[model samples]
Target chain A: MKRLRTFIALAAVPLVLAGCGDLSNSSMSTNSGSSKSGSTQLTGQSTDSDYEGVIQSGHYQVSKSRGVTNTQDSGNTYNLKSFENGMLNVSKKVFSTKKYVFQEGQYLSSTTVQNWLDRKSKSNTTGLNPTDNGSKSASKRNPIYIQALEEQDYMTQKNNKLSLGGVTIGIAVNSVDYYKKTQYGATYETKITQAAGEAYAKKAANTVLKRLRQKSALKNVPIVIAVYRQASNDSLVGGNFLAYSTNKAGSTSVSKWTPLNVKNYTFPLSSGQSSPNSNDASSFSNFKSQVENFFPNLSGVTAQAQYDGKSLAGMHVNITTQFYSQTEIISFTQYLQTTAQKYLPSGVPIDITVSSTDGIQSFLSRTKNEKKFTSHVFNSY
Target chain B: MKRLRTFIALAAVPLVLAGCGDLSNSSMSTNSGSSKSGSTQLTGQSTDSDYEGVIQSGHYQVSKSRGVTNTQDSGNTYNLKSFENGMLNVSKKVFSTKKYVFQEGQYLSSTTVQNWLDRKSKSNTTGLNPTDNGSKSASKRNPIYIQALEEQDYMTQKNNKLSLGGVTIGIAVNSVDYYKKTQYGATYETKITQAAGEAYAKKAANTVLKRLRQKSALKNVPIVIAVYRQASNDSLVGGNFLAYSTNKAGSTSVSKWTPLNVKNYTFPLSSGQSSPNSNDASSFSNFKSQVENFFPNLSGVTAQAQYDGKSLAGMHVNITTQFYSQTEIISFTQYLQTTAQKYLPSGVPIDITVSSTDGIQSFLSRTKNEKKFTSHVFNSY
Candidate 1:
């Protein structure tokens, strides 16, 4: 009986040890499997994260086609004239097809292009890309490329002469922001707080996007616009209020009021219309109108369309005009005033401000009489 | 007799032919020599022609010197002991042995580095150098240097590290035309005209010399400035005039007058001031005062000075000012109208023009009352 009991205990001990070993092995295998799966999952998560910004920003799709041909010579040798001519032909065709695409974005906006040209002209001030205005030769003259077509044609000409024998066309569409200014006067800080009145943000966004769509080369291209609001004040008296100037007779006084100087401006949205839908109908029509009006020579179908909301808000706008002669602009201003009066309601006070571009503010006082409703003059040296 | 005649004829023919050949050779040699000599003379004349403008425009001279090094590095080798101490011996010595020569001529005014900073700050513009305003970190984030700076400093400071390594610095000093609008309605063409204006010829000479000097960096280490001036109208109707409005009580009429549109304003000459010396006294003194007042930080001695006839006559002054905020400038102007009445004389029209960095022009109309001044505002998108 003692021998049998000892044998049973030994057998139970072995069985218990075996069972523990099996459990350990199974747990280890499960942990290893989990680790592998976790690693793959991590990788996928990271890839998604990386793609998030791009997807949010917007996506641009491109496609290319090659032309090929074969020819037989008299010596029974085959020549591939089709590849040569076909490549050129295809490239030209592609360029022509996408020409309108390149013409529909910011480049088409009169204001945008004008701004660019003006900046280029002021390269002298920035000391970047200095031009020789003294050069007498035509070749030395800095030709201002005003038209998108001109720039494209020049690029094509250069590419055709180089190793890249065919034209390479590209279309890029982006969303942009629109901004506007509203004023509240008290202390500087107070004014900033109450500066952006209600509806300023929405109006800014609408105005900017609408204008951009009306004038840009990327109008038809898929775009996304974004809107943002920022609060700031022209005054240093920081508080939850804005500044305002009260006019009693000819005198002005500043006072603070509630409301933060928050302005909402709209910018282009990042995600564009990826797949064609009826939602793009208005945008497409608007883009078509812009192209037809501005780029009469361009030819192509709208390849893509999208909308993203974005904006640059709480920015100050400064406009400076340097008059070599004052009369022209004054006359022009008077004409503008006359025109504005014709359109604007008479009761609306045409309040205007004047300042000197030079630090000397005394000019404003000396020539107060010269200031007119239609024309506000600031001295720009 | 026939032989004698033939001999005589042959001798005569030879003599006649020799005479003709000698005359031709003499004339040809004279012509060839004259041609070569003429070309040499022309070359010599060209040099003088180039210098004519520089000499005739006006005379000015200046001298400059770079400050000596204040700290000298000790040529001591570092050991582990010294390295651990974290102390390096640098000898403090003042040395003025090296003196730089500044030729007698007008020197281009050295632009204050601070001015660049001021402009950048006022306009919310950045990237004057590679290291400016978090350019390095921004550069790491973006492809273009300027964009990087703007994004990092102006947009968001999410991840920014100030790094000055691999940065480039550029410094430039230039003499530019000083243009001021005159009471006349005419505009002055302030650009360097081909052969017109006082410094046109000098400008041409300087341009050529500048090109020549570029062969060696040391050759043009210090730039010389030639100041030029032309008459321009201060009124908006003038060539250099910028029209701006201040205050108009009611409807106004504009008069068309030739002198009012005069291209130049002539200042009366004081006693003993004549051609080439007219601007010697008052004008020079005024310039000196302006410079001294504006550039108090500059440490240097004036080497020489010369001037044209007429104090402030036939001179152009380019004025540029930067303000911390556009509203601040406007406020300052209002203050001037209210408090600084003495500085601003009545009847003399003042025009203010505003422009963006991109050079978009917006003219401000003059108003009679300060209250209306608040209304003329435009925002930049």
Candidate 2:
């Protein structure tokens, strides 16, 4: 707390510095003076060739140089020379990649989801093992429960156009239940209880798109959002349940809630355990089979599942979806490109133009040759 | 400890991400694929005028444009356009004043001396308060201590430089202490106490430096080593001690330690309290009289004492080094021009060529203006 107090005091002193001079007046006056000189000289000129126009085309590059200057006082003078460079080469690197679109009901998850959420919420719970019921620890005893009550909530969205290697992703975060706590007995509690399950599920979907951005050539693609609820009685050693609402074709409201079918599906549990060994495989497989029967045309789209690893460990379900049209894909791609260009380095630009067949073949050939050379270099190293 | 362990674990993962990327042959080979046509070109050419040059001139300008880049993929693009124009301008303001250097034999006293020492030893006893007797509380139960130890220490030397006017000025610090404390207890207990004190002292010095770095413009500066010890009772309330030392004459050591004079300086029992009011017509007048007696024959220098609505608190001493030589002044003007050019808009180059009289006049004018502006601003705000 003293360090925190020290930092607060340190931060407060800057206000005293801010009132020292009118930096704006100085800069504006300096700029005005410089502009006048430029207008008078008219010595410098720029052309399209000089600019390379990579920014317009959605690409970027990096370069460097060195220079010298003079310093003086009284009757003495000195020259100072500096050598400058950057850690990453700006010119050759890609700042953003082409876009990719996910079809209706399709989902993708990032490997970072489970780990990030777990670490972030580990201190919230009071239970010795929140994910393991056998631990027999009181659930609400941990500080995490209090923190969770005041934590912010967030959502994730897919944006593959700005990604390199055909992956695009974005997240929307919001504060939820912030600064609030529950009271029990004589103490007031303020901890995060449920570790942002909804946010992580959305994040998983976005991550897959990010990974695909670099490899895909599409742009301005559209994405569809699908929501699911985690079913109770799920365990790390057994199978897990997922429920979703489905509307009838004729009726747009008051749809029935359906559980996914798992027939013919064998879910893995830990390194050596299987759902079948726990005698829950039959039920999970039946649920999977039922979902398939409901959606017979679900194919061509990617599917991913997210779970509280501790509670629903080992068992992963792939709820597949349908593909999107070319027009929708293009629209989503454009949106992604715009987002990527906004944040990407000035050098790296997204390439949105459709490639010709010849161009694709040539690219493949060149890639093969480059791969061979790379292999040799790697082996030598 | 558990929280610390979790924090470290979370931090380590990000660091590992930096090294996980492998540039294998397979990866390199993939780079040859023909990207979108014309997409590989670099945009944004390097111009003679760029903020990087301006920053090297020792002047910091705040621009609407974000000065730092975030690599966390947070998807938030900073927009500087919304900030007021000219907000980032930094001007070179001069002060036609003299600086007084504290030389050997100058004496110092007051609560500030004790505060300075306490601050210097802060790191060793972090999270622990010093005892009422000014000894580290950790070993205060027993009394009667002696024996000097080899301690590392630092000293602060403030150079007259451009500052955001009206800001409080203080010394740059570097210090280390190596010493022993004797206890009336058993010899074994005495050894343990001394060892702890020495270790704590070293840590305290480092902590003080860390705190000092948070001060404006003092971060990352070179430091000098010094020897520190508790003041003797004879050097207390009415006593005096030498507070100055001489550097080795011919050696250009950046870290040369100098002894300072101290006398009649008593630690304040409460924060923000100063010495008893001077009996002179005015506190400032009394402070000026004392300064003159402390430093005789101080000509060609302007001195002023500052007060926080009480007794004299500190003094501002400036000395005129030399009149400018035409050639030297010209070179200095050119340096200023070049520095301005670096931050100026593209295609703008500043050329400064002023006669000796004009150059000197300009420097004096800016200095006077800055001082006047600072006084008015601080007084009003």
**Top candidate when judged by TM-score against the true structure:** 1
Computed on C-alphas against the true complex, the DockQ of each candidate is 0.01, 0.01
TM-score of chain B of 2: 0.20
The C-alpha stretches of model 1 lying farther than 4 A from their native spots are A1-228, A231-332, A345-372, A376-381, B1-263, B266-319, B338-340, B352-381
Prediction RMSDs, each to the true structure:
39.5, 30.2
Candidate 2 residues lying further than 4 Å off, grouped into runs, are A1-269, A274-381, B1-252, B255-381
* lDDT, model 1, position B226: 18
TM-score (all chains, Cα) for each model: 0.20, 0.16
Report the interface RMSD that candidate 2 achieves against the true structure, in angstroms: 31.4
Candidate 1 residue lDDT tens string, A121-216: 443332111243654333443322111110111011111111111121111110111112224522211111112332232232233334434533
- Model 1: share of native contacts present? 0.01
